[model samples]
Target: MEEKYRVLADTAVLAGEIMLKAGAETFRVEDTIRRILRTSGFEHCEAFVVTTGIMITLESSKAGTISLNRRVSSKSTNLGVIDQVNTISRQFCQGELDLSETFQQLKNLTPVRYPEWLTYLCMVLTAAFFTLILGGGPAECFVSAFNGLYFMISRILNRRLHLNDFVFNMFASFFMAFTCIAIQTLILPELLAEPAIAGSIMALLPGLAMTNGIRDTLEGDYMSGAARIIEAFVIAASLALGIGVGMECCRLLLQALV
Candidate 1:
């Protein structure tokens, strides 16, 4: 009994460490944990709040059978109880942490961080350039540009650049706004208005979030997915804010020219 419990705790600790290091995106971590616990027959569970996220601990001592103790602390905001259980099951069977990074690779949070604008510029350029290549109309291209720029920038910055989420978001929005202006300028005298509005805002689409959310929900992990869905909506709104500002700028400029 003591031996089994020790195994569970050690494996949980290792898995938690990997999730923190790799930025295991919430749902993946939770699922991994859930699997591990179920396999170990630790039926009861509770999570303790931690500054980074949650520390889930479980113990199940059924009848005369010894007992199983499962404990893990995860820093990721995304993983929920179900994921934790799954992780436990895998651990019980394999004696290895099943943790794998679902999002971008982890990076060291560093000094000498470039200004958000510079990071934003790189992101916008990546998106806008791709949009132009797709031969989208100026408006759609710009919309796609907004989508690509901010998200990719966020991904790189959040994942690789190791910046704060809010800081990255604000700059991504502003950069998207700035880049939209440039995009408007490069287009021929026509092809501006509705299409442009559509294009620039397309970056905020719920497609990615929706898919991930559904997967989590269907797997019986509701909490984490709900959080993800909320996050996606908030990000979409942020992109809209950028597109709106840029659209207003375009509108005003055209009015002056006329």
Candidate 2:
């Protein structure tokens, strides 16, 4: 019985960790952990979740107590994984799955990712449309598409190199800004750099992060909310810094040429 309780606590904490790292709301994460533990017969279960950490404890007169702490250093958006975990938890609670089966399911779960070509195509379309919406002409839109393509490639390479979010965003933004300026200066002198840069850089913005931060704050997860907000700010600042540096360097190059 004690061994079973230990497994339950560990599995519940693991589920919460995965959800938290997948960018789920803090309240939702806590609720999920609590529900899992309660369903597993741990009536005195406690789960505390933040954007970067998870803590869970289960206490029972018969089983003593079990506790765990997991620090999450990286996060990404994976709704599919979140949904799968939620389903597993629901099934377990309904007695459709035993503890061993639940553990196996969670252990074997995999995140779904879009195809590379599809992702690239979507990025191109996003940049092109954003450029048009920002009052750029068809020529500028075309240029922005190429910039977006390169930006996507840079992001993929950064991820492959295992760079952090801030570094990856900075690198991608620098590449985007430099390419936009170079294209405007050399290939399409008529191309407006402002709209092209703005449109392409939109792809690198921390929109989801900012939104989640606000949501967490409103839900009373103040610490997690503040951390996410600060993260978003840092990421945005890095992107701006990269863009500024790239533009300044391009300006200097143009001046030297003239």
Candidate 3:
């Protein structure tokens, strides 16, 4: 009986952690945790979730009480994991899944992402099209695409190095700005920096973060919403700082050359 209760609590907390780290809204995360606990035969279950943490408590007259808290340090957008967890939870609720089976499924679930080459190609196209949309000529579009390639490489490196989002974005933006300015000055002197920089930087914006923040706020998860909003702003500020530093360095280099 004690082992069963422990498994239930562990499984519930694991599901919540997965959902939270995968960028699910806070209310949705809390609901999922509650449902899992309730379906597992714990009627007096409580779950509290925020952007960076999760707390769950389960109690029964016979089984005493069990509580778990998880601090989520890193977060990323992986809708695939979120959907898989949701499906498992629904199946559990409907009696299609047992606790052991559900636990194994969650443990075995792997996040799916686009292939690296395909992702790079898509980013390149995105940068190129954005440049063209912003009144850039064909040459500028090509330059922007080239810069996007470098951005993709930097992103991959940052991921491998386990850098934080703010540091990664700052460095990636700096690399983009520096590369664009150098290419413009040396290879295509006529290339406009504004369009290339703007278009390339568009690929680095935290659009999903901001959207999730607003959604969480509207759902009444005010604490999580505020945290996500601040996170998005911090990332944006880092990108801007990197761009500013890169531009200033380039200006100084040009002045020295002349």
Candidate 4:
């Protein structure tokens, strides 16, 4: 009985970890964990979830007590994984899957991401089209495509360097803005920096973070919601600061050259 309870606790924690890591809201994580635990016929089951961790406790006279803590250090947006986990949880709760089967399925679930080449092409096109949508001329569209290329290169370097998020965003936006200014000065004087810079950074915006923050807040997970919101704001501020610095340095450099 004790071993069975331990396995149940482990299963619940594993599911919660995967969902949380895949960027599910805190409230949703807690709900999913709670449902999985409740299916075990425990007298008392409690699940606590935050942005970074999960804790679950199960208690019954026969099992005495069982608990688990899972620390999730990293997270990314993978809605596909989230949906799969949710479906697994639902199946387990509905008796379509036993605990062991459900656990194994969740363990083996992998995220399906786009191919690297497609992702890069989309990034380049996204910037170019955004420039056109923002009323930029053909030159701005052309320069923004190169800016997008630089942005993708920056992402690849950051993966190897493992830089902090704020520092990475700052450096990326700085490089993009500075390059845009250089292109305008040397290659196409009529290229508009504003639209090009704006479009180039659109791919880096924290739109998903902001949306998840709002949803979490609406779901009554205030702490996680507030934390996510603050994170989004910090990223935005870093981008703005980098752009301002880059453009200012370009202005001074051009003045000196004249």
Candidate 5:
């Protein structure tokens, strides 16, 4: 029935919306929803819902490199239609739905927007690169950088604006950095001399945000993507701030020797 297809399409759209806003890919959601739908009795139906935020805005660079901003959000949905969509997706997640035949239907599925942890790792990696550029040896720099990054990212994700994220990273980074050094000291003493800067950097990459933003833009989901990009840049700035503070402290202490 035409009605059934509409319902199914709408359902797929909503699934995409939820995931996009939650930092997931449109195609990924579509595939999952479709998989769920196909396995359900409503497989023939196509449902769709246009999210308010999944819009993409493109910007072209001077070099003619085109970039886009992605954002995704839900506007409204039909309860009855949504309920059916929910049933299918839920069933699929629960393994109650059979989509063996529909598996290939999603080969081109957009990337599954990465979770926060992945984003954090990217930040750490970026930080490590910078730290290495700064005078810290490769091994030591990563040890300290990653230690700091882990505490910083973990606290930030689990606590957001809460004092926990802030204070935890502030203090935990130092501890984690030391822990990394200690571990290296015990297992790979060769790495003990690696700069704390490197360790701190490794601990800070926010890979997810960059990937999510790009993915969002590609899917014409600008709202979610822009928001994520802003967040990622903010995190990058914060890492820079931390490094600056550390450098300042070192400068002050080293002044006496000079």
Candidate 6:
């Protein structure tokens, strides 16, 4: 009975950790964990979730108490993984999957990602189309495609540097703006710099984070919602700061050249 309790604890914690890391909302994570624990016939199952961690406690007359805590340090926006976790938990709760089988499935679950080439291609297309949507000409669309390299460069540098999200995004946007301004000044003077910069930086915007923050807030997850909103704001500020610095530097250099 003790061993079974331990296994259930492990499974519930693992599911909560994965969902939290994959950007699931606070209430959702807590609810999932609670449901998973309830299946074990625990008299009391409590799940506490925040943006940064998860804590679950299960109490039964036979097993006494089993408690688990999982800290989540890194997170990314992956709605698919969140959905997968939800599905698995639902299955476990519905008796479609045994506890051990559910645990195995969660353990093996991985986020679905597009190939690098395809991802990059989509990035470029996204920038180009955004440029058009914002009333930019063909030249702007062309330049925005190159500016879309921001994602590629950031990914490469982040793999080696492991900087936090704000710093990483600031540096990437700095590089992007600098290059875009230089191209406009030195080679593509006829192209509008604003659209290209605007379009490319769209990729860096924390839209999903902001949206989730609002949703969480509406759902009464105030702490988690506030944290996510603050995160989105920080990223936006970093992007603005990087672009401002890059543009000022480019303008001064051009003045010197003239």
Model 4 C-alpha lDDT per residue in residues 96-176, reported as the tens digit of each score: 998789888988887868898998999999999999999898889888888887778778998999887788888888888
TM-score, ranked from best to worst: 6, 4, 2, 3, 1, 5
| TM-score, every prediction | 0.52, 0.94, 0.93, 0.94, 0.42, 0.95
Q: Which segments of model 5 are wrong by more than 4 Å?
A: 1-23, 30-161, 164-196, 253-258
lDDT per residue as tens, model 1, 1-258: 656554544454445445533334455655454454454566664432211354556666562233333333322233433344344445445745322321111122121246767766665665555556555555656565555555665666677767654455555655556555555565544544344444444444555566666766776667766765776777667666756666566667767876
Which residue pairs does candidate 3 place in steric collision?
none
Tell me how candidate 6 scores on lDDT: 0.88
Candidates 1 and 6 compared: the better one by lDDT is 6
lDDT of each: 0.51, 0.85, 0.87, 0.88, 0.49, 0.88
For model 3, the stretches where C-alpha displacement exceeds 4 angstroms are 187-189
The lDDT leader among the candidates is 4
How would you encode candidate 2's per-residue C-alpha lDDT over 13-113 as one tens digit per residue?
88988888888888889988888899756558898988878888888777678889989878888888899999999899889999999988888888878
**Candidate 6 lDDT by residue in tens digits, 1-258:** 788788988998999999889888888888899999998887899998888998889887877888888899999878899999999999999999997899899999988787989988998999899989988899888888887787788888899989898888788778778878888888988878888889888878999889889988999989999999998999999999989888888888888998
- C-alpha RMSD by candidate, in order: 8.3, 1.6, 1.7, 1.5, 12.8, 1.5
The list of candidate 6 runs beyond 4 A from truth reads none
Q: Model 3 — which ten-residue stretch has the worst lDDT? A: 35-44
| Shift of residue 37 alpha carbon in model 5, Å | 7.8
lDDT of 4 at 167: 86
After best superposition, candidate 3 residue 206: deviation in angstroms?
Answer: 0.7
The candidate with the higher lDDT, 1 or 4, is 4
Q: What is the Cα-based lDDT of residue 77 in candidate 1?
A: 31
